[model samples]
Target: MSLLDVHRSIVVIIDLQGKLMDMIYRPNLVISSTIRLMKLADLFEVPVVITEQYPKGLGSTHPQVLSVYEKLTTKKFYMEKDSFGCCEDQFYSILKNARPDTNKQQIIIAGIEAHVCVMQTVIELQENGYEAHVCWECVSGRGEEYRDHALQRMNQKGAIITNHESVGFEWARDKNHPKFKEMSRLFREGQITS
Candidate 1:
């Protein structure tokens, strides 16, 4: 929809743990895009939620991501989940509490291991009436084939697949907007490079 519509969207970063992130290809790309998404969300005042899948075993979220969260004045809900699909009771409860007032019932998602955690979460989010949009460049798996298949399946289930920059511009809408300069600067400086 329009940038105003996407402005009401919530950003959910799932299971981007330190150990798990190390196993994925192009981890830097994922981390950079995710952090940029977080920063943009902050600028727009959109809510953000992060989840760690079995963090006790996989380890906490990467230091870079954790550092960003620490600086946010917006309350970020961080959950430790054993379930692959983060749309379970706990996360659903968080969603219920943080539900946007606008009609944009959307979830902008990014994370690690696309084939499992990200895939299952997006599927469940769609099933639960949320428009789940997955940022492709911000997600990855241990293998390219698995990541490809997961994206294909998510597309089949109606998850909008896109890249980080597109999502930013879609949300920003016009160059004349107040945040346009900052977003453009971020893009030009390669802060959100994929």
Candidate 2:
């Protein structure tokens, strides 16, 4: 219930794997928004943790996403999980520690399957006392109904339902905070996809 602080934020990119990515309702939008979020995270010096659900089956994170991630010099980690909810995964504790500041309690999530993984992760993070900010356009399910309802459900449960642009400006907090130009370019690149 607060404006996101860059020092308190950690970007968690979840389950944008191949087979699964292709199944989402708006995979391109998810990819585009996620890419932007990743860039913002790096530019703002926020840490990031990426999760792939059973890469052996789902394929690794999408190539476009991986490319952005690969170029990030900020604190980062890539973990593969069997658990739908990231908190349930074995690497949960380590992922929490991945950020330079253990005080980074705000979870900025962008990924696929809004109804399952994204929903469970947001709810669980809140239950555990972390402020979860879900990037709306950066997540989606196999069907529009499922995706829409899941987002509504998360909002009802106290998760801050937000978009990628809001996150960047919130993190920057002011026009002179630095990195605004690069952040603006990412936004202008278009978060929407055909």
Candidate 3:
């Protein structure tokens, strides 16, 4: 129920690896939404944490996504892990090091395999007292049904189920905000429909 405060938030794009991304349902939609979300985060100066679940096996985070991050602030925190839930020790360490202020705990989660990695990450993030906002449009599973069930399950478990556009506008708060023009441009390029 509340809008995401950029000062209290961080963007977490998880496990959007190579082959897996191509297999996910609606891969183009998910990737486009995620790219826009990351762009919004960059515009707002929110810390971005990207993870790959065994990249050696799954391949690196999709090249297109990587290219976007590369253009943004060089402050990208990249983590590689075997764990499904990104709430691991290394993740905590990187996050802590990224922001250092304990109060910045709102997590905007976007990525693939909604029913598995995304689901587990949201659950553990909520359990750890972090406000986990799941970007519905930016998440997908191997099947549409699984992604739908995952979103329902995460919502039931207290993660705020939202889309990338909602998150972007909520964080921007007002059109007069300094980054508004840039944010608007990104959304337009994304061709996100109401």
Task: Judging by lDDT against the true structure, name the best candidate.
Answer: 3
lDDT of 2: 0.86
Weakest ten-residue segment in model 1 by summed lDDT: 1-10
- Clashes by residue pair, model 1: none
Residue 116 lDDT in model 3? 90
All-Cα superposition RMSD per candidate: 1.9, 1.6, 1.8
Q: Compared with the true structure, what per-residue lDDT tens digits does model 3 show for residues 63-150?
A: 8888998888735798998988888999988878777866648889998789999999999988888899999988998999999999
1-194: candidate 2 lDDT, tens digit per residue: 99998888889988999998777887888888888888889898888889999999889999999999999998888788888888875556755576535653888988878888999999998888889999989888899999899999999989999988999999998888778888887777743774
Poorest 10 consecutive residues of model 3 by lDDT?
185-194
> Which pairs clash inside model 2?
none
Error of 3 at 103 (Å): 2.2
- TM-score for every candidate vs. truth? 0.92, 0.94, 0.94
Cα lDDT of candidate 1 equals 0.82
Better of 2 and 3 by TM-score: 3
Clash totals in order:
0, 0, 0
Clashes of 3: 0
Candidate 1 wrong stretches, greater than 4 Å: 1-4, 191-194
**In candidate 1, what are the lDDT values of residues 69-167, reduced to their tens digit?**
778766477888988889778897787666645554678899978999999999988887788888988889897888889999999998999876777
